[model samples]
Target: MGKGPGLYSDIGKKARDLLYKDYQADHKFTVTTYTSNGVAITSTGIKKGELLLADVSTELKNNNITTNVKVDTKSTVSCRTI
Candidate 1:
C-alpha cells in the first residue's frame, strides 16, 4: 500500500524507453493540402513504425483556432500560415 513497492515509480521511465529506444527505425508519412485561398501545406515524415499519415491531400485549409495536440512519434511538423 505504501508506494506500491516502487513498481509504479519506474513505469514512466520504462514506457519512455520502450517507446523511444530504437535501432534502425523505418517509417514514411506525407501530408499535402491546398487551401481554398490558394495556400498550400505539405508535410513528410520518415522514421520508426508504420506511418499514420501519408500523401494526405485536403481541401479547406484555414485553421485559426487554439487547440492542444499530442503526437507520440519521431517526426517533424512544420506549419506555415499564409
Candidate 2:
C-alpha cells in the first residue's frame, strides 16, 4: 500500500483549511502538532486524490519509523464540496 501526504510545521496550525478546488492543479497537504492531555499531537490535512509519501518511503524518510502514519487521510467532509 502507498503512504500518505502532509504539510508539516513545528509550531502553530495552518490558519486556513487545506483543499484544492481545481482538478487541474496538484493537491497539497498541511501537518501540525498540538498539545493535548499533556501529550504532543500531530494532525494531517490532505486534499482529495492527493498522494502523500508511500509506505516504502516512510521508513527510509523517517529514520525507520512508520507508526501513526496516514496512508490515505484526506481533509474532513467540509472540504469535499470544493
Candidate 3:
C-alpha cells in the first residue's frame, strides 16, 4: 500500500495561491501543520533544491527580507518583497 500527498486546508490553499501570485516562482510551495508533544506549529515555503540551509539562508538574507514570525489563530498571509 502507498500513501498519496494530502490535500491542503482552506488556509493552506490560500497561502499557496498568494505565494505563487506574489513571487511568480515556478515551484509550488505547500504549507503543512502538525503537532509534536502537544505543541502546534505551522511551516510555509519550500526548501531550495540542492542548496544547504546555510546557503539558502545566506542567499535569502542577501536578496530577500529577513525572516519574521507572526502568531495568529486564523488564516492570514504575510509577505515581503524580494
Each candidate: RMSD: 11.8, 21.9, 19.9
- What is the per-residue lDDT of model 2 for residues 1-82, given as tens digits with 9 covering 90 to 100? 8976554662334342234233345455455454432323344444447455321111112344323433433321221110
Sliding window of 10 residues with minimal summed lDDT for model 1: 65-74
Please provide, for model 1 over 1-82, each residue's C-alpha lDDT reduced to its tens digit, 9 standing for 90 to 100. 4654557667688788878887455666666655568555555566545445433222234466322222334443333333
lDDT of each: 0.50, 0.36, 0.42
Which residues of candidate 3, in runs, are more than 4 Å off? 1-25, 46-82
Output the better candidate (1/2) by lDDT: 1
Maximum-TM-score candidate: 1
RMSD of 1: 11.8
Better candidate by lDDT, 2 or 3:
3
TM-score of each: 0.28, 0.22, 0.20
Candidate 2 lDDT for residue 19: 40
| TM-score preference between candidates 2 and 3, better one | 2
